[model samples]
Target: MKLALGPLLYYWEKQTVETFYQQALTSEADIIYLGETVCSKRRELKTRDWINLAKQLADAKKEVVLSSMALLEAPSEIKILRQICENGLFKVEANDLGAVQILAENKVPFVCGPAINCYNASVIKLLINKGMQRWVMPVELSRDWLIKILAECTQLGIREQFEVELFAHGHIPLAYSARCFTARSENKAKDDCKLCCIKYPVGRPATTQEDQQVFVLNGIQTQSGYCYNLLNDVPSMQGLVDIIRVSPSGTESFTSLQDYRAAVNGTGSPIQLASKECNGFWHKIAGFQTQQ
Candidate 1:
């Protein structure tokens, strides 16, 4: 199995973002995904800058993929989607139908991102027929569900020949909305909200009345409370998934990516505790707690 570093879901300073990827180039991650998939208001890096970064990573022997925004609200967004489709160098990750259409129209071999809701074999085959090079299961999909889908694919004679990637680790991105919670919390309107999400680097953790961390808030996106850590599960799931994706959380200097890569390659020692790690959705359980 290989390690893929997913796109940065949070907004960071331009220099900080660039430096993170530079360090990630030498990390245990084999594939690197570039571009912003979150709110478009966060413009720390332009499209050209992302392209340049992708090129630099590609030069360093890492497979690079450019991700599209999950929500495309305007014509300008479509134009940006067109630009990503027209790039024609690195592979594009389609997060929305608009991106899928653009990539299909341009005949670009692309990846169907985790947001595509591909829970069945027919959907997978449809995308494959449209030139989808790879398809990632949604983060909420569980092990049994995945097995069933793969079985159906086998029955249909389309059993994930291209590649199958999973959101193996990170804060599970639960949902996105038109309303910006960061703005509301800061007493600002959604339209003129002064980029309040920049205040939370790791995102504002949502807790219950008991003060238990339950979710994370990022502008309009809701994410999981416990960061997903599936380091221990990789060995058993060897051939099921081609790449294990490590979504960006804190700074990239911590070497967790390398640790995951080591764990996947069976070169690193195993941890005693899988209880602390979460495989809830992967195991088809309630997501707040672990499932081992």
Candidate 2:
């Protein structure tokens, strides 16, 4: 299966984003997704900047896809989405239904990001008709759920029309809200907040009353506290998945990519890092629990 670098979910400086992609050019990842998929307020890299970076990565022979924000709160955000769709270079990863509608209207082939609600074959078939070239399985679905969806697709004779990508690694993105959890954590209102998300590169962590890590707060996006690792499950994906996505977290993400590549190639065992790992969602268990 091909390895893809999922879009950067955390906010980073322009220099940091540039350096990460530069390193990604030499990494084993075959596909690279660029653009901000979270809050629009995190504009470290604007639309033009993202397009320029996409051009650079495309020039280097890396398959690039521009990702859209998961939550679009205003018309300005829709304008930004239009600009990304009209770029005419790399593919676009539609994170929400509005993006899917815009892409459908433009007749642009796009990748359906995991955040998009594609739960059934009817939705899959509809998206395939609307120029969906690939679809990332929703993070909450299990392997059996995917099998059932694919089975329905097979019955409909549309299984091969699009590629299947799994959110193989990284902290699971659970939800998005109108309120910025990060800003709230800093005792600031979402509107008047001074872009506090940039301060925490990966995101601010939220723990339970027992001091047990439970969630990560990044702007309005809520992610799982534990890092979702699927290195051991690579073999299980074999022919069912076309690509495995590894979401970029921080400076350590590059090494994680290398390790994932090794695991895919059977050259190395799964790296057991210091972070808590979970694959329960993939195994049809509780999202935060480990079933392996």
Among all candidates shown, the one with the greatest lDDT: 2
TM-score of each: 0.95, 0.97
Assess each prediction's global lDDT (C-alpha) against the native.
Answer: 0.83, 0.90
The number of clashing residue pairs in model 2 is 0
TM-score leader: 2
- Residue runs of model 1 more than 4 Å from their true location after superposition: 252-254, 272-277
TM-score between candidate 2 and the true structure: 0.97
216-268: candidate 2 lDDT, tens digit per residue? 99889999999898888888888789999999987577787787788778897
Model 1, 5-44: lDDT tens digits are 9989988889889988888878878889999887888888
